[model samples]
Target: MALPPNSETERGVYLRNVFYNTHPTEVFSTWPKLIVEDYAVVGRLINLYSFIEINLRRLVESWTDADLLPKGRIKDLPLGRVEELAQTVLLWPEANLFALKKMAELRSLRNLVAHFGMMRFPDDDAFLFIAKSEADYKKQTGEQSVEDVMLIAVLDGPALPRLVQELEGMAQWLATVTAQILKQKADAEADVSKS
Candidate 1:
């Protein structure tokens, strides 16, 4: 039996069809299979985000007081918020501007991946990460054209692994800088006590 045009399944099928310029049934049949087959790519994307988020959380926690902001609270902070707090508090002299910038870029890319959908054209094999709805795209980026979203990264491309490596490197850099700052603070406190 065919579902009525007003049925929930029919509504879901065609809601975003205008933007893709494709029949709803094509998307309905292909999207699930594409997503499932690309499960490993999804895992890599998630892991890449986690490496940066976890490190940023740790850096923020190291400086924030447990009484004012509990460890669990810090852990739960959004990636962008944690990045902002880490930037404000961690003032070591050896901080790398490039790495910090890269971390910010990673946060933006992670947001896009989390909020948008990945799609590939019938003729093209490269799945693009893009906002499916025009309204949502405009709301997120304040741009009228969904085309402005840009081809930032591919789902299964070499860029994903490279980003993972870069994030790991940044995590190491942050850990070293945090340790040095803590040591300096402790040493200064000890000196003051002895004097």
Candidate 2:
């Protein structure tokens, strides 16, 4: 039986079609696959840190006792720019900027793999350049000649678990700093009010 089309249903189907059309086509070649895998690792790294970022934001949004603001490695910028929210970044005291720069290179390479092959995305040359640069970025950053990136995977059963554990440490350290900053701000305000 023929039926009349609902406007909402028609819109939903149209949106799906657009999304499928915009998605990048996968490259069957081996090099592209490796690059995509590397990109997945990069996402894991971001995922590992995301927890800390979210926690810090939640702390402020939840507005628990001022103690969570102190003693923790978080920077609470309360009441400054309600829109800014200001407590997104949390990093350990000795976080390695050098490693981050290298990782950025890897991510850029992966972007090419996902968006470029025979479509409106990244290109092969871009991926190779990222791989090559990642290999040598350590030297440029004045490190101990790092020829590879050590990704700490999420799933257990191998060395990846340990690496992921270490990465979490960095996030925790950042949280601690944030707490200190919040405490410092509190103390300063208390002093001002005393006058």
Candidate 3:
């Protein structure tokens, strides 16, 4: 599936850098490296979310044949609003809806990391979602508390690669769904013209 050109060039560059620089061996080698790798993972996750959101907006605009951003607008519309419009107007297919719902779950995690800055352990919801074992958490962080478990989980643990894989899969699924939607729309328009 061919996605439209990325609107966030700087973000794309930063994501590429983060991917190239982050390594599992380095992350496990030292505490400092672990922290940096954690930051990189969170940063990359945010960038992927932004990329998906932007493409979703573009897809909606193209399907509607109207500019989401007009001359009178002081600022662009929010992603939630755009998503609502897409659901209502475009009527996304079931597969697309499932994919978007999964993305929304990740969006919550992204918000927690982005807003809270990982100064403390993630909340119960995030902790459970990441699903780190107590024994493993104790061995890794030297503490048995859930807070410590969450701290390690968010920073450098199994959650990192799992979240990355989930996001990558979602991005690919969205691209394929978007391509199918566009093709269907084009075919419908052609059929109307024939009539």
Candidate 4:
């Protein structure tokens, strides 16, 4: 695809292509055939989380460049701190709340999955972070036991793809918002010059 004229839009497009073109599903699908099902699940989850984190940083940096956010606030801040600022600045369209919550949950899950071995699946923690209730978790996991929850049946299944889709949506939203803010800034500058 040709890059969008807007830099922020181009960044969003690039992020989506990176995530979808990587084909995480195909990469992890082969693992189970190798009898490393746990690795498949863990690996996919970590990969998804990492991609989202990277895109979030990119989006925040774009916001800073457009003057939509104060540069000093994000300087040297951790992802969590950047996310906190995002909640306030990106709260338009109400549905953004769901996106923010999902990102936060992914961050928490990423920390646990990346640091801890798969021997201890943080099912309870995952449930708390992402699910509204045990029933909701079960619904998402198809009533699978917590022990069976991290199986490829779930990770390589619908949930992973849905997450990728959500990330793409968020990238588009961020790009659109960034473009609007930058246009506004440009207009203000032009007005000042005319004056």
In terms of lDDT, the best-performing candidate is 1
Candidate 1 lDDT over residue span 1-195, tens digit each: 111122244423343333256554675466433445455655665675676666666557756542324446676776667777766554535447667766776665556556656564344444445445666545555677645333222343445556666776786786677677567657877898999
Worst 10 residues of 1 by lDDT: 1-10
Q: Please give the CA lDDT of all the candidate structures.
A: 0.56, 0.39, 0.55, 0.50
Error of 2 at 79 (Å): 20
Q: Give the TM-score of candidate 2.
A: 0.30
Candidate 3: lDDT of 170? 87
In model 2, the Cα lDDT at residue 184 comes to 71
- TM, every model: 0.54, 0.30, 0.50, 0.45
Task: Report the Cα lDDT for residue 8, model 2.
Answer: 55
Superposed model 1: Cα runs more than 4 Å off: 1-21, 31-38, 65-78, 91-95, 119-122, 130-135, 141-158, 175-195
In order of listing, the candidates' clash counts read 0, 15, 0, 0
Candidate 1: residue 92 lDDT (0-100): 36
Q: How far in Å is the alpha carbon of 67 misplaced in model 1?
A: 13
User: Model 3: how far is 88 from its true place, Å?
Assistant: 3.6
What would the per-residue lDDT of candidate 3 be over residues 1-195, giving only the tens digit for each residue? 111122355644544344345463443343132256666777888888887787677667665553433333222767666666555654567877777767765676665455442422222112211233565446445677655233222332456558877898888777776787678767878898999
